[model samples]
Target chain A: MKRGFNFSPGPGTLPLEVLEQAAEEMLDWCGTGMGVMEMSHRGKAFMSILNQAQDDLRELLMVPDNYKILFMQGGAVAENAIIPMNLLGYCAETPPIADYIVTGFWSDKSQKEARRYCNVNIAASSEGRHFTHLPRQEEWKLSQDPAYIHICTNETIHGVEYFWEPDLPGVGLPEVPLVADVSSHILSRPMDVSKFGVMYGGAQKNIGPSGMTFVIVREDLLDRALPICPSVFTWKTVAENNSMYNTPPTYAIYIAGLVFEWLKRNGGLKAMEKQNVAKAQLLYGYLDSSNFYCTFVEKDCRSRMNVPFFLHDDALNDKFFAGAESYGLLQLNGHSSVGGVRASIYNAMPLAGVQALVDYLRDFERIHG
Target chain B: MKRGFNFSPGPGTLPLEVLEQAAEEMLDWCGTGMGVMEMSHRGKAFMSILNQAQDDLRELLMVPDNYKILFMQGGAVAENAIIPMNLLGYCAETPPIADYIVTGFWSDKSQKEARRYCNVNIAASSEGRHFTHLPRQEEWKLSQDPAYIHICTNETIHGVEYFWEPDLPGVGLPEVPLVADVSSHILSRPMDVSKFGVMYGGAQKNIGPSGMTFVIVREDLLDRALPICPSVFTWKTVAENNSMYNTPPTYAIYIAGLVFEWLKRNGGLKAMEKQNVAKAQLLYGYLDSSNFYCTFVEKDCRSRMNVPFFLHDDALNDKFFAGAESYGLLQLNGHSSVGGVRASIYNAMPLAGVQALVDYLRDFERIHG
Candidate 1:
């Protein structure tokens, strides 16, 4: 059976080549006589896999030598708390204040979870505009001193993204450590890893699978974990132990390694970024031109990864989804929080897949209009 | 190439059939047009897979109706802290005291981790005997009102196991909640789920892979989580959300579901127990009679899952490991903490595998003796 184009927001589409390769190696990995999942995390075979994955990812992203790439668990949601537990020690305040730029659903969740561990200050919010655009950096209410500044670079549900990193000095805030939750669009484009104090995301979207979380933390930021932090989750412990403080999500890491290799083999992130931009333009361009379909997010801030749009007639929503699914487009239905259609054309999603969806969109409009 | 007898302790061997089935469905699952990993966790296809996995696991374990099963991340090492964060609220003392029966390596680790969250009391320890045996229950110094009594039912490293559940009355202890870390031996044999307050394990051993951690806790114990507990790791929150508090290790859960099905098709835990006993007996019986190799654990309390034995001449350790590997045996080397050889014959390991190892053992003894 032919595989469909999967637009799942997360645990989302993976390159067909990677999936085929993984399946081929399911029983035996590199002649190790054991499946990757069956090998001990401490064993030489798995260590090599882990090391190679880290190295390839570091090279692919041009990650700075001083930053440590940690393969973690619990996803970005868990990191909401883990981040404060690790970073709050830098603040001398009684209850360390964490400044957050809440752009959409994910950042909102991050701030709420952070409240459980530290004093959270919303430095800026795009919610007033329904998360359609980024709040200008200059408008943010910078705190006198914050343990760290956090932002979700790309909002998966809202389809809003930051085209450029926030320049703190230009925004009138003192130089501070910046943390970005790049879960949705991590590897889709080249990133300046050196600019951020830390960058992390779930592996499910552009990386590989759901279990492993990627944390790229600057080396100096690793030392200040709160006493309450779980030892395995402590950045200091994990980095010092080389993400082997515990048995990591080995299989997930292995898959992510395959993805990193696939990304490298296919012209790296630069090529991926070009394709992602074209796919986004094809969908957004169609929606912009067609009166029958509409996108809520502003054009300038539209995500290159997730494109959430709606049909003009609410009654056509179900019909639109059904028609798309029939054409081998799957999980195109939007998030329940934002009801419509969401096409997550991530790094693994090819131009042909987007063109297929675009073709279906035109065909559906002709029949229904 | 033929698959060798894999003896790596945790992240160990899996049923070949499960791996084959996973491979067949790698590109597309049940004509869903998307692979299991590519499907959204909230999507109907994945929801069905998740529910089926949970149901199959419930049936296989005969879990009590009052218990809630949580699929979490970070393996057993992470759960060491997560368990206390969720269970230590019952103690009203200045600093809650957790009673730990440290029989071997894992239990010692558990108690040490618990110290970071609460006061830990070593109620019983086999360290006096160099972890060669389980300390008799009668010899334990019970904590009058500890939050919970913790034990590692099967110590994967030291090859010690508790054959019988400790009856508090038999040991002059109170009827406090019992928490057992059954990482290496879970599902290898029949277990009375009603006997313990909680039974948790990392999936890498008998379940599926390294990413997912399973926690089977009685419903009454879910609400005692401390204020500091990360919401994602909290049992109450995880159970309320059906382990979807955060994006669960979806692929790992799917693989675990496949394993549960595999376990059922091969006869439930009862049949598995008989086979496990036979495998353990074959290996142990040989070591008991042989002058070249010896097992340290007391005969009455030996793990049916992990069998750590030693070459009488320590210098031959490398030779024994090399010989075993050459004979289609793999990972015969023991953990670094234990400087010998360990043959982890888990549920997925066939009797033939053990027989092959035994045959190799005999041949090696004849040549080296």
Candidate 2:
């Protein structure tokens, strides 16, 4: 059966090869006599899987030896609160302050959840412009001696992404740590490991599956967890335990390990980034040339993974979706908050899939334009 | 290729039919053109799966309409902290007190986590007796109007289980809600859902896999989250959103849904309980009649799901495990804390598997005893 091009913001498309491999191994992984899900987390077979996944991920991203990569549950949403709970107490001020540069929905959430544990300072926000653009480094108002500066490198909902890392020193906050929520676009490009204190994301997009959050935190920041942090979520305990603090989402990690292997087999992050850029350009170029379609996000800051555009006539929206579905295009409807169409072309999305989407756009426009 | 009898406590064996069905649907789920993992959480196909799973579980457990079933992330370990965070604030007391009945490892952890949010009282403890027996209802020392009582209905690490509900009324504390962690034993038999305010478990053992936590909280107890509770883990928020407050463990829920359907087809909980009883009896009866092997947990309180035993000559432990592995029996090693053997026969483990195990026990004794 031919699979549809899945453009869902997250829990998005995965490589067909990875899915096939997982299916083949579903009943019995290797000759272990038990499936990955059925194996004991402490057993040798599963321990090897866990260790290999962590190592592969580390190698793929060129993660520094000083940074601890944690396999966690609860996605990016749980980490919103977990981050503050871990970092604020580490700073240990009379009233620890955390600065956030709110680029879109996710970073906005991060700051709000942090408000529960510490004083929050919105260093800058692009919400005043409907999240169409990212707040520039010069615009950021860093709080003096704040625990950490938070940013969402890619906003899945608003379709904006940071092309460059936040410069703490450029903003006169050299000692403050930089934390980023890169959920929608982690492996889509190469990232400098030393630029941030923490880089965390949900693995559903540009990786594999939901239920697992990959956190890369500097070793120095591991022990900053507040007394209230759950033992399993405390960075120090998790790092010390090698992310087996609990069961560590065995199957999700297994599937993600397959994805990391896939990444490595396909020329690593640089190659993935090159393909991703090409896919994004094809879709965006077509959107720019079309008279019947328009995008709300500023071009300079638009997300390569998520492209949110709207029909010239809103009345044809349902028909547009129906036509897209018939052509094997799926989940193109924009987020409810941003009413339109969204094409999430992540690392897993092939250039052929994007070309098919472009062909559909032209066919749809020829009839309606 | 034959599958082994897996007995590794949590993340133990799963129903073969469920695994087969999942493999069949791995590429394209019911003509939806995407695997279950690729579907958007908000999409109709995945939503139906989530709702159907919730409904089937509700029917199977006979959960009352007043109870809210929350599909949450983070396994039982994370819930050790989440439960206290959600419930303590509901009582609205200055430095609220919560009572815990420490039966074993899990209950001890639950109370220790509760200390972060509220004052915790150890109402009764079986640790003094090496967790071999359950403290009777009369032995529980009630706290004066504590917020709630916590218990680990089944201790996975140590094989003790509560066969009867805590009689709060008889203990003169009818008003206190009871929260039980039934991770290892959930769905093994019919549970009296009305007796507890909350029943939660990690899905790895009897349900499906790791990464998903099933939380059944009474409706009245929904809004009592402490000020610092993560919004995503808050019961009321998750319940209202139909477990879609965030991208839930989508694929895990789908696999669990398949298990639920399998449970229904196999004559529901009563039939499952009968088979479970037979399996437990076969294993325990063999141990009782054998001079070479013995179980640590008391007979009355032995968990049907988990059985921990020891070889009479500790030196033979390695030989016993190697022999068992040769017989296609796997994960027979006990937890590191308890150096012995544990056989976790969850609902998914058929009676035939237990029979094979008993046969192995007899054969090993004849050869080595």
TM-scores, all candidates, are: 0.98, 0.99
Best by DockQ: 1
lDDT of 2 by residue, A203-284 (tens): 9998889999999999988778899888988889999999887887899999999999999999999999999899999999
Question: What are the DockQ scores of the candidates, in order?
Answer: 0.85, 0.83
- In the range B1-369, model 2's lDDT, one tens digit per residue, is 778988778688889999999998999999989999999999999999999999999999999999999899889889989998898885746789998999888889889888888899999999999999999888888688788999999998789988998867776766678999999898989999999999998999989989999999999898788888998999999999999998899999999999999999999999999999999989999999999998878888999988999988999999999989988899989889888999999998889889999999999899888
Backbone-clash count (model 1): 0
* Residue range B118-190, candidate 1, lDDT tens digits: 9988998999999988888788887778888899999999999889987765555445778999999888877
Sliding window of 10 residues with minimal summed lDDT for model 1 chain A: A167-176
The deviation in Å at residue A366 for candidate 1 is 1.7
User: TM-score of predicted model 1?
Assistant: 0.98
Runs off by more than 4 Å, candidate 2:
none
Model-by-model lDDT, in order? 0.90, 0.91
